[model samples]
Target chain A: MLQIKDLKATIEGKEILKGISLEVKEGEIHAIMGPNGSGKSTLAAVLAGREFAKITHGSVKYMGKDLLEMSPEERSKEGIFLGFQYPIEIPGVSMVNFMKTAINEHRKHRGEDPISASDFLKIMREKKALVEIDSALTSRSVNEGFSGGEKKRNEIFQMAMLEPKLSILDETDSGLDIDALRVVANGVNKLKRDDSATIVITHYQRLLDYIVPDVVHVLFDGKIVKTAGKELAIELEEKGYDWIKKEVDSE
Target chain B: MENDQDKIISDATSGEYKYGFYTDIEIETIPKGLSEDVVRLISSKKNEPEWMLEYRLKAFRKWQKMKMPEWAHLKIPEINYQDIIFYAAPKQKPHLESLDEVDPELIETFNKLGIPLNEQKIFTGVAVDAVMDSVSVKTTFKETLADRGIIFCSFSEAVQEHPDLIKKYMGKVVPSTDNYFAALNSAVFSDGSFCYIPKGVRCPMELSTYFRINAANTGQFERTLIIADEESYVSYLEGCTAPQRDENQLHAAIVEIIAEKRAEVKYSTVQNWYPGDKNGVGGIYNFVTKRGICKGEYSKISWTQVETGSAITWKYPSCILKGDNSVGEFYSVAVTNNYQQADTGSKMIHIGKNTKSTIISKGISAGKSQNSYRGLVKVHKNASHARNFSQCDSLLLGDRCGAHTFPYIEVNNQTGIVEHEATTSKIGEDQIFYCNQRGISTENAIGLIVNGYAKEVFNKLPMEFAVEAQKLLEISLEGSVG
Candidate 1:
């Protein structure tokens, strides 16, 4: 469902992502493990069409269509969701209103009628239950004054609400307690379908234990140097990323 | 992003003023100039009593002796009073008892402004007094209001019918000698709305006035007076719009309100005068004096305004809490775009024990405009335990725009409490991108963020006016953000 080939990106004349590539099929979950400064967040941002990250030379194809050509809003309407590591705090914009606008925009792009008010409320209730988000929090301004755990859970709730075709979770497990992580992971797992895919980008293996991946790839120096089954996460947890770095250095 | 900014700027600068259309009709205007003769002619045109004519002459003499005040942070050219037409009115039509007697062209003008004058089209329970040029053309639901002993009509009509009330309350709140513009308005004021809510009576519906400047070369000087008698309550609204012109037009208006013992009065205004073009040629110079007095114990007064137009606006709607345990409030949202300039705020004076007041002002500046908020809060020694809270916030859209705040507070009473807070912020790029990432376009994001910022003051506006104010905020800031 997604393909990237020799992706090289830069910001302000400094190259962050060197030659990198990956491929993912539908119904599969891929975990990209990388150390700090390995360009994991940059990849996620680029995929979400962030304007500052200049794609020096590369191509990203999602369902055989050019992904880089779309604007950030268009990419969102196209069913690509990125759960931000640090969610933005939009003061005065109620969560319900924000979600409604996002959902209606997506529906408009698909040439469908807007979801009625009752149906929208029902969806919100269902999603809130799936993620264990407080109704009061959803009624308030979007992410304003929310605790760290609540922000992450809110992101997952948004994911369930939008029901995107491709979900990218960047450091979603960070700053989350064990129970919160489990709730977020369970929400993601419950929303997964055979026609969609997931990419979990993290530095640790704790989150992978809850949402098991079909394949594991080690991204080192902006390039994927190792690929294996989900067991690779356990190996990395035990041996650390030094082994992968040594192997890449020796190669 | 650069392209987006360019598109926004072009959009903001290119759109024509929507209320610029002129109506073709026979209009009678006095020769352009200001003199005792002109003032006397205006009084004679209205067929006023001798006392009324003498009042105008006294105000004209005061205006001639009073030099224009230049203390405001505004760059104004010398105004030639003799170069402006003092009075202009639509030719008199025979007195009629129904809306059918009104001129169809005038009705069409109101319709074009989205104000349906036909009683059948009015769904909301708002009685409107339509004032065009220098005279009030039609006042709807007069008999219905009269049934409640609620006096709602044009100032000219009130002068002839309720001469006692007019004589008693005309200059009680804001005297003719109060300021430069007030003196000028009192001298040659043509027409405006007058409302009187009797003792122990509540106004059944919202009372509104729509002021339009239709005749060319004639300045519109409107005077509004509202009196809420003992134990009474009334909410009054005023709105205005003007056709675009290449030559600047002056609009000097006075609004005086009196709230007696245990009475409450709420006044709201949405001023949309033509704000000239992008190059600052043509527009209305709006200099207005509005004040209210709480004369008896337990009285209250509140002023809420959304000012989005005028080439140069200088106004300060104030209140005097003279009664014990009285209350006052001022909530305003002023937006300036293109070459517009606005210097507006409120003043609260506490003379009574246990008096309370609150002020919230929001200013938005876009393009090359300038917006300022200047306010004053004073508590006298006799005002023991008086409390006041004031907050002023400014939002800037483009790099070329400006926002300023000047708050003055004086507490002579040791037991008085006064607090003031001010903040200035710009529409940041990160905020826009965050919304864009959520499937909202940049323009929509700006609108949402701006409306959010101004929500506090917008909440104070009446329901229908709140919606119009929100839409006006959006239109005024169009093409200002990227």
Candidate 2:
């Protein structure tokens, strides 16, 4: 469903993702795990078409189209969703209104009329139930004063609303307790379709226990050095990132 | 990606003014210049009484003696008052008994403005008084209003028909000697709306006036007076627009309201005068003084304004809470783009015990425009337990724009409680990207964020005005983001 060919990305003048290449097929869950500053987030940002990450070289193809050529909005409309590592807090913008606008934009892109207010409310209620998010949280400003776990759950709620073909979950498990992490993982698991794919980016293996991955890739020093099964996450968690750093530096 | 975002911001800030079309109808304009004779001529032309003529002469003399104050945070150029035409009116039949007697071209002009003057077709439940240049062309639902002892008509007609009411309420809140613009407006003020809700009567419909500057080089000075007697209630709104011109036209106007015991008055304005071109070569210089006074106990007055036009705007709609336990509110959303400058806010003067006031102002500045919020909250010595709450927020769309806040609070009564909060933020790239990642375009994202930011003030506006206010905000800064 997605292909990355020698994806070289940079910020300012420093290279982040150095010639990374990967491929994922339909209905498969891929886990990209790395320590801090290993270019995992940069890879996710590049896929999402974030502007600050300059594509110094290489190319990304999503659904057989040049992903880098599309705008962030167009990419989203074309079924690409990026669950931000740190969700932005937009004061005064209610979550309901924000979701309504987003849902309408996607509908408009598909040449459909905007969802009726009643239908929107129904969908919102169902999604909230699926994600176990309280109605109070959705009624307030978007992510404004939200707890860390609440923010992560809200991201999942948004993902459910958009129903994107490919979703890059950037540190979705970060700052989440066991219960909140279960809710988020359960949401992702429930929303998975046969034609959709998920990329879970994380630094720890705790989240992997809930949302199992088909393949695990350990990113180190701006390159993917290790590719293996889900056991690699447990191995990395037990052995720690220092061992991987030592191995990569020696290689 | 940064370049893309910047391009979107630039395009949004370059939004064109849609209401800049000039009507090609025959207009009769007095020669340009200002003098006592000109004021007298305006009065005689309106066929005012002797007392009214003396009032204009007095105001004209006061205006001549007063110099334009320069305390605002504005770069106002020296105005050549003598070079501006004091009066301009569309040529038409001197007396009109019905809509059929009105000129067709004039009716067409109002229709094009989305303001259908025909009462039967006005489905918005609003009674409109359309003012073109120096005279009122039509005032609908006058008979329906008159049946309920509610007097709604033109200012000139009120002066002629209900001179006693006009004499009692005119300039009672904002006196002619109030300021430079007030004196000038009192002197050469043309046609505007006059509404009086009798004691214990509630106006059945929304009273509105649409003012348009159709003639070149004409300074539109309109006077609006509204009086809600004891136990009465009324909601009044005014809208203004002008044709595009290369030379700046002046719009100095006054609005005064009086609320008696148990009376409630709500005044709203959607000021959309021409805001000049992208280069700021021409537009209107809107200097207006609007104020309301709570005269008796338990009276309430509120002001809601959406100012989105004019090259330079200097306005402060205020309320004087003089009655015990009276309430006052000022909600405003002022937007400026592409070299437009706006210095607007409100003033709340608490003179009675247990009085309360609230002020919420949202300023959005795009392109090279400058927007400032200057407000004052004063509690007199005897106004013990007077309370005031104010919030001022500014949103900037581009790097070239500016936002400023000047809040002054004075309390002589130790029991007065006053609180103020302010915040200024730029439309961050992250906010835009967050919206874009949700499939919303940059333009729509900015619109959503801006509308959300100004929702507090918009909530106070009447339903239809609130919708129009949102649309106006979208058009004013349609293309730009920071």
Candidate 3:
């Protein structure tokens, strides 16, 4: 469903993601485990078309279309969802209104009529139930004064609302307690489908316990140096990334 | 991406002012220049009483001695007073008994402005008094208002028919010697609205006045006076627009409101004078003095204004809480774009014990415009336990624009509780990108962010005025979303 070939991204003249290539098919959960400053977030930002990150030399094809050519909004309309590590707090825009505008814009891009008010509310209720988010939290301004756990769950709630074909969860478990981690992972697990794919980017292997990945890739020095089955996460968690760094250094 | 944002800003700043069309109406204007004879001409032309003429002469003499204020953070060029026409009135039937008697061109002009003068077509429960150039052409629902002992008429008509009320209340709140603009407005002010709600009576409908400036070189000095008698309640609205011109026109207006014992008054304004072109060569110099006085115990007065036009705006709609336990409020949203400059806020003077006041001012500056919020909260020695809360927020759209806040607070009584807060923020790229990622366009995203930023003040306006104010904000900030 998504393809990246030698993707090199830079921000402020400093290369972050250097010579990175990955491919993910439908119904697959790919976990990219890396240490700090390993360019895991940069890869997600590049896929989401963040304007600040410049793609120095790379090709990202999503559903057979060049993703780098599209704007951030167009990428969103094309079903590319990037769950930000630090969700932005917009003080005045209510989550309900934000979702309505997003849904309608996506529908407009697809040549479909706007969803009716009743249908919209029903979908909101259904999505709220999926993520176990409080209705009051969803009614307020987007992420304004929201708890850390609530913000992560709200991201999942939005993912459920958008129903994107390719979802990239970047450090979704960061700052989340065990209970919040379980709720968020369960929400993502429930939304998984045969035609959709998930890319879980994390610094630790703890998040993979709840939302198990089919393929685990270790990213070191802006390149994925190791790829293995789910058992690789357990081995890395037991042995640590230092051993992997030593191996990559020698290679 | 930066180029895309620059394009958006340029497009928003370059959007045309939609209400810049002039009506081709023959106007009878006094020759340009100001003098004793000119003031007398305006007074006599309105058929003012001898007392009114003496009042104008007194104000004119005071204005002659008073120099234009230079303290505001504005770069105002020296105004050539001798070159401006003091009065201009559209030529029409002298007396109008019904809508049909009014000139067709005048009716068409109002219709184009979406203000229907025809009583039957007015779906909202609003009585409108239409003022063009110098004179008030018509005031709708006058007889219906008169049935309830509610006096709603033109200032000229009040001077002629209800001289006692005019004599007792005129310049009582905002005196003729208030300031430079107030003195000037008092001298040459031709016509405006006069409304009086009787004791214990609530105005049946919202009272509104639409002012338009059409004649070239003519300065519109309108005077509006509203009085809510003891136990009475009323809501008054004012709106203004001017034609596009190469030479800046002057709009110096005076509005005075009085709320008696247990009375309540809500005054709202949507000022959309011509804001000149992108280069800021010409527009309206809107120097207005609007004040309300709570004169009796438990009285309440609120001023809500959305000022989005004019090349240079210097206005401070203030309130004087003179009665014990009285309440005063000032809510404003001022927007300036493309070389427009505005220095506006409100003054809350707490003179009575235990009085309270609130001020919420939001300023949005885009393009090369500069917007400043200058406000003062003063509590006298006797005003013990007087409380005041003030919040002023400024939003900048582009790097070239500027926003400033000047809040002055004075409390003589130790028990007075005063709090002031101010914040200035730009429309950050992250906020824009967040909205864009949600599928909203940059234009709509700016609108949403700006509206949300000014939502507090917008909520204080009447429903219709709130909608109009939002639209004006969108227009004023159009294409300014870099």
Candidate 4:
């Protein structure tokens, strides 16, 4: 469970997220549809506790705790996963070791014992199969020399490994091909449970086709301008964002 | 613009004195001055031969006559020899049966450095020569190294026991008249490791030297000489740490290496002197001369260094290729953090035809540090078909750090081929965000990027030293990277 009250975020003192309020319960998939510069990614960054952007006035409560007070790592430990649009290329850190450290940090934060190396490898293999990722990528440095599709799929692969309670997919579907998109969608769809939730942020309705959402919201000028069922995403794709903007202007 | 000014102001601050440690131990230090008498006293203390004493006096006179060179691209104050006590040796009475005979203070020093002499000597079973201040106190695994016909001893002992070897090759590659600091080190230099790999013999295991400067108001002028004879091979490693001090202490050292026909010499150094604090009021002023000569045909010399300390570093470890088909290589990774300044590089001289040399340098500057890579490639008129390749890259962790590259290329022969490349990069916030989104924290992300930037140089270090170097790099850039 999470609550966002009048969330307004700014980067370089320019307002990006303007007075947005929302609530998400357990086991729900929320699709955010918007055009470019719609503050979709800013919303994810604000939730994950990026320090650069300032939260001028907002209260974000996650599981009855203040999310703004935590660090980026602490937010991660609290089960907030933000799948990056562009993955970083860490040249010498092997993907397996990186994933292992993350899993252990999260586990340690939760007061659980560290996972055994054998168990880590076993989990890696199992989840890696869920995302249909090639095992060779795990041996190289994290995202170093990785293709665009492989990078997106690697994000999903990491999501499956961490098993977060709430996952934020910020434009994960931007660079993925159809097959890779299917693989990523299947991975997210498979990892869902009764206690977990997903917020799929996207510009098109194509991603919503794979991972259908319970609610679709349209974001414009740093504010959510419209809310509808899954057909809203389909309607925005058919009629374009200008129609939505005109409707908001009329309101 | 604000970022640039922050970097400029921070660089103006100077380096740290992280390695200043004091222990209650008796030390036989000379009077705080430099003269012919001081050199004579140092030689007499070792009971050296007449020729050796004469050599020191000659070096002292030359040093007195020569002024310190100001041509280096470093901001350093004038060093007053009168203010520096040139000699300091631990008075625990040097004797070597095992690590147990080592001083407890020295053992504590090594432990703080993360290289426990007792554990390393017992587990990995490599001999350790512990050099505190300016003298070598104990040497481990002597019998094994000696069994292989490899002569390992202190320079003082070498002067006494094997005068022939010392007289034959002393200062041959880099003579006492070579430069200002080399001459200074030659005058009042205390003691350091001396190794000679005999013909056709492979050294049994790694030979290590851990140098520490414990005394305040004292300069460490240590000398190390290693010679690998024909058909022989040697791999030498050196590491240094100093106690924290506010006033910058002077460290001027000379390291000479000679590789004969069909021989290979590998020398690696991890210099982690106490870098100064963020304000950069005090640290070590490292002025060193390290050079090697490939005398016989097909000889090889390689230098690998991980320099992560010192307020100011000025050194050039070079090689003179004299034999046809000889090979020379230099791999270096120099990192300066929190007001540190380093000006270092290498030189490769091609004299023999068809000789080849390779230089790879990686510099990481964080928290307003200024690190420069200055190198030279000179080919003689007779060195037809000689070749050289140089690559220098730098990674700036913050907007306040600076990295620079200065390369000199001289060619006299029309048939030589030389290639040079350089690049500078910054670790931007976007890069960090990419890693954070994938669940990797910022610190781990920094470590990964830095390690990746240093992989080329890390490959040159020995496997064990490579691990330690990586760990040191990650720890050194602790607050800056994150």
lDDT of each: 0.90, 0.93, 0.92, 0.85
lDDT of 2 by residue, B67-154 (tens): 9989898888888989999989988888899899888989999998889989989999999999999999999999999999999999
Candidate 1 residue lDDT tens string, A3-64: 99999998888888898889989999999998988999999999988877789998999988
The candidate maximizing DockQ is 2
Candidate ranking under TM-score, highest first, comes to 2, 3, 1, 4
Please give the range of 10 consecutive residues that has the lowest summed lDDT in model 2 chain B. B1-10
Candidate 3 lDDT, B177-259, residue by residue in tens: 98999999999999999999999999989999999999999899999999999999999999999899999999999999999
For each of the candidates, give the backbone clash count: 1, 6, 2, 11
Query: Model 1, residue A4: displacement in angstroms?
Result: 2.4
Please identify model 3 stretches exceeding 4 Å from their true place.
Answer: B1-5
- Residue B90 CA error for candidate 4 (Å)? 1.9
| TM-score per model over all chains | 0.96, 0.99, 0.97, 0.94
Q: All predictions: root-mean-square deviation over Cα?
A: 2.0, 1.1, 1.6, 3.0
What's the C-alpha lDDT at position A102 in model 2?
99
Compose the digit string of candidate 4's lDDT tens values, residues B146-222: 88888988888788888899999988988998998898888778888899999999887888888888888899988
DockQ of each: 0.61, 0.82, 0.61, 0.42
**Candidate number with greatest TM-score:** 2
Give the lDDT of residue B283 in candidate 1: 93
- Clashes in candidate 1: how many? 1
* Model 1: per-residue Cα lDDT over B133-200, one tens digit each: 99998898888999989999999999999999999999988898898899999999999999999999
lDDT of 3: 0.92
Task: Identify the CAPRI category of the predicted complex in candidate 1.
Answer: medium
Clashing pairs in 2: B9-B481, B11-B479, B12-B479, B12-B480, B13-B479, B13-B480
* Top candidate when judged by lDDT against the true structure: 2
